[model samples]
Target: MKLAIIGAGMIVKDYLTMVSDIPEIKLNAIVGVEQDVPTMQELSEKYGIKKVFTNYEECLKQADIDTVYVALPNFLHYAYAKKALESGKNVICEKPFTLKLSEMRELKKLALDKNLILVEAITNQYLTNYKELKESLKKIGDIKLIECNYSQYSHRYDAFKEGKILPVFDPKKGGGALMDINIYNIHFIVGILGKPKSVKYMANIERGIDTSGMLILDYGNTKVVCIGSKDTSAKIQTTIQGNAGSVIVNGPTNVLSDFDINLNNGFSKHVDDKINDHRMYEEFKKFNELVADHDMDFVKKELDHSESVMEIVDMALRDADIQLG
Candidate 1:
């Protein structure tokens, strides 16, 4: 698949780092503002990309491109992705697909109507370690509780405190702990347990945004809690408890790494499937496969999962009384 990238931010470097190794997908062009032209040109020369444009629409007009990866800020995801789909190109958008569930539903409808692929570029769902964690859950028997925590002090928080409200802390940019960090926790939980029967959120609010928050999902007999924070750091881990055994996953939930499982009987096992490349590798590989095959069923399944995750995020934000600016 020939692909065009729409952003030249820090995260775009990570995506490009991985895409360089994947031969099936070609980096056709890059689009950014006038000020970013030099950096884009440097990147284009280094990566051997064919074109660079300051206007995204010009990049979209390229007949050689078959897909577009939207890596812009949170608020721009919906607009850029919708335009890409309408322009007859598959879209692979970054996480927190949209600030609201309503926006996601509209994008889903558009993708279906246009017969194009639209996928959220979330890592955990595509990682081999997460798949192993799911398989290990079977040995744990009936699940009683699941706990996932993803928290790290953001570099942007310093600027935020100085009254420089960048996109990460600005409500208008869909900035908050829930959207930036907690969304991954939601993805990890919902991908495993599906949607909960009821949901509630308790957050630490600062300047109209959630700095840290805890979300509770009640699945009748089973209960799950997801903790996400950007103002503080924690020993990030994911634990799944059940009747017969328990599974402990270490390292960031977004990266595939080593984990251990302990059974009630006395047997213990450790599993690791760490890859050398950045976490973005798995996602691009899967996107290439789906787009190449024109697999709408697989795309719909992923979209359904993404939609459920966004629904939970919307509820959590509403309960916290946090509005996207």
Candidate 2:
């Protein structure tokens, strides 16, 4: 797939770092706004990107690229992905797919009508360790409770305290604890357990945004509490509790480093099923397959999961009275 990358953000560099592993993906162009040309050109020269484009629309008009990777800030995802689909190219969008559910729905419709693959680049869903953890759920019996914590005090927090708002802390930019970090825990739950009965969000609001927060997801038989914070840091751990036993995942949910299983029957095991060194590799590999093969069935399934996630996000924001589009 010849690809046009729309941003020179940190995530774009992450993708470039592991580009060699997936021979199916090819870097065709690096695109950004005129003001970002310097960064884009630097990225182009470094990654051997053949074309540099300041105007995304003009670049999309060309026939050289078949796919666009929208790794821009959270607020730009909808507009950028929409334009990419309108250009008749598949899109690999970074997650939190959109700040609102309606936007995600529109993007999903656009991709389907265009008959192009549209997939969110959420790390957990495609991780080898995550898949194994899901498969091991049966051994843990019926899930009764789940607690997922993904909290990292951003270096940006010090600046935030000084009344400086970066995109990661700006509400207008779709930044906050739940949307930024907790969304992975949201994906971890929604991707595995599907939609919950309902959701409630309790946030530590500072300067009109959630600096830290706890999201509760009820699944009728199971209840989940996900804690995400940008103002604090802790030893990240996720536990899936059941009548039979429990599974504990240590470290970041995004990385899924390794996990442990403890059964009531005195059975315990440690699992390390990582497929690659780069946390982003596994998902992009799936993106390559889906886009190259035109796997609409798989794409639709992913969209379904994405929609469910957006629904929860919508409710969570509503509960906190955090109005965002």
lDDT of 1 by residue, 1-325 (tens): 8989899999987777777778999988899999999989988998888899898887888647999989999999999999999999999999999989999999999999999999999999988888888999999899999888888999888888888898988888999988988888889888888999998999998899988889999998789998989999999988889999999988777884778999999989999875645788887888999988999999999999999999998888889899995
Candidate 1 off by > 4 Å: none
TM-score of each: 0.97, 0.97
Clashes of each: 2, 0
RMSD of each: 1.1, 1.1
Alpha-carbon error at 206 in model 2, in Å?
1.3
Best by lDDT: 2
